[model samples]
Target: MDWDDLRIFLAVARAESLSGAGRGLKLDAATVGRRIARLEETLGAKLFVKSPQGYALSEAGDRLLPHAERAEQAFAGAEEELSGIAGQLSGQLRIGAPDGCANYLLPQVCARISDANPGLEIQVVALPRVFNLSKREADMAIAVSRPTAGRLTVQKLTDYHLSLAAHRDYLSKSPSIGTKADLRAHRMIGYIPDMIFDKELDYFAETEAEVVGLASNSASVQMHMIQAGAGIGIVHDFAIPFAPGVVRVLADEVRLERSFWLIRHADDRRSERLTRFAEALGQGLRDEVVRLEREAAQSGLAPP
Candidate 1:
């Protein structure tokens, strides 16, 4: 079977229309339709059911989805490996991480990668949820939880401390937070449900209010809201450095720490872009942790 035909089918399947996929490939609709037909013939199965609405996957196509994806991924890695011999590391890097860590580190990481690998295109997937490496949702995942099962290549990336922070204005307006009780009296921004947060390390606990004034699934956005004076929120020690309007109120007293894991499928060792991106992330996080430790020491505040 022609690899391009399967790729053409995948594109059409995703786009849900010949015309849409055609526009993407800079081909006319007739060409797109012909390619899909050729692919279906080669596969000896109807991949899509054409309707007035759009093309939807057929039963055969649904079954072939995983196979198609794996084939493409393997082909990409093989091509990159050969290309790298000519001093070129070329492919897309798909990465997912929690909002807390991404807030400070993502920009610098992207800049460094782009500068070093001109042929590589980095696709940063910043979602409210952590992408599962075991499920192959991403090329690599920087997860709060350690991978328990799966053929995973996991590394303990770094530990980060969390602290209660708010805009300097909020502290000035509200009474000072000298004690835990003082924190209960003010408005607080908090994360929404079963997100990737440390529970045993006790980074988070039920506040005095038992409810939050504002909530978000994203730690970065929640931290930004706090800096925007939305309210005090739990933020990592590293996130605070980049936060403009925020300051630690009872910094000397409170802290929360969690481990970040750089994870990928063990099989992904063949992927050049994935491996390099993960290495960059691990090194960057370690460097940031050192910087944060220095800042915490200068402040005479106990590290969270």
Candidate 2:
């Protein structure tokens, strides 16, 4: 019934765990658990179903979610109005994206935003899975595909390039890869087929290459493995330039292009901070893609 208790419930619902919600609320796990319990007692209904995986919203919780979100938006609007009077942005803005973008791109974009709004706190979650807006996993997300359904807003950020790449040493010592057929003979590094969260991430499906022998769910790890000369794998065109000794293989013969989509929950769309951050973030990503494409063009690589 209390606003504070509802806030805790929202956090817990979003995070799916005691520690994660506690971290966001800056409260200990015990306090969060106690508050949730008190809220449940007041309503005389179970709000969450706890399991080994995490907390899931119960039937009652689902019924309460929309109303609670409306209250949250009301608070956010009032806060934004006040912050506007002060001429600054404040509070946390969490952006989630695939590891490839998160590791290679978002840090720079976030830094610029932070410099402009010192009062704002930017939280980036470099996830391998699709971001769930319905669960409020992230305030915004840079995704490969737009959501087909949900109370969500989607925008096309930009299209970027990816291609098969490997370390020079690995290419030299390994079998020749003059054509796509040769990829079958080489050890390929990529996301585990079963663990791929999005269909867009199923890179192997686009090629004749068999199941990857060296696999991981983390893009960072897959990139590192390629750089370490483990095997040939697909990599972002923008990121390969930074990895010494790594070079694009069959640049023309094997090229993959994917677009990034920006997504946010409709409920939070009115928040000034979220709106400003989305604009800045999208523009920043577009600028970065342009720069990378220019660099790739100069190198006579894939058409960026």
Candidate 3:
């Protein structure tokens, strides 16, 4: 019945383990367990069933979820309202994104946003897999493809381009790559085929390239391999500016277009703080992508 108890319950449900929930809540696992026990006693219902895998929500817990989420949203709204400075973003905002965008784009973009709103604390969770916004893994997520399901709001953040690239030294020493077939003659660096988390990241899907001699699930790692003259690979145009030694190879023949989408919980539309932050974040991303791509083009590492 208490909001604080419901808050703890929500965290436990999301994390599915006392230790995990404790870490997020900054409380000890024993303390969290005691709180859950207390909450269950108050409700006279068993909210979770413990197993080796972790806590699985009981029927009562599942039933309590929607109400708890609504309460969480209400608390967040109240905090935003009490903060009083509607224009200034304050508090934690976590963004989950693919390693490519997080590595190439977010640092500077987030820095600028933080500079403007000194009280804002931003965390970027960069991983190769899709983020679960419903579980609160991130306050928001930037995805390569639009999601078709869930209580979510999606916005196209920006359209970005990618091209086959290699270090200048590698290109100079390697045979001419006048066509896609020529790619077979060279060592290729790319995402591990089985590890590619998204279809859009399968840059070589349509190509006849034999195999990835060097592979990583992380885009930044692949870019480093290319920069080290390991082999040619698909690199984001917005990322080229960061690797001065890298140059586009077969750019005209191997260009790819992909867009980043800003995804958020549908309920967030009711919060002005998140709405303003989303707008600012989207605009910053668009601008940074343009600037970085232009710089890459001027450096002759990407198409103008």
- State which candidate has the highest TM-score: 3
lDDT of 3 at 224: 96
lDDT of 2 at 35: 91
Candidates' C-alpha lDDT: 0.73, 0.84, 0.91
List candidate 3 segments past 4 Å from native. Answer: 301-304
Off by over 4 Å in 2: 12-23, 28-61, 84-87, 300-304
Ranking by lDDT: 3, 2, 1
Tens digits of per-residue lDDT for model 2 on 68-122? 8988888888887777625667787889999989988888888987888888899
List, residue by residue over 9-114, the lDDT tens digit for candidate 1: 7677767899988876788989999988888888889999999999999999889866776777788777876776356456667778776666676767677767
What digit string (tens of lDDT, one per residue) describes model 3 on residues 1-304?
A: 8899998999999999999999999999999999999999999999999999999999999999999998999999999888746468899999999999999899999999999998899999999999998879999999999999999999999999998889888887888877889889999999888898889898887566898999999999999999998998988999998998888877777788999999999988888889889999999999999999888777774222
Clash number for model 3? 0
Which candidate gets the maximum lDDT versus the true structure?
3
Listed per model in order, the count of residue pairs whose N, CA or C atoms clash below 3 Å is 0, 0, 0
**TM-score of each model, paired residue for residue:** 0.75, 0.86, 0.96
lDDT value, residue 188 of candidate 2: 90
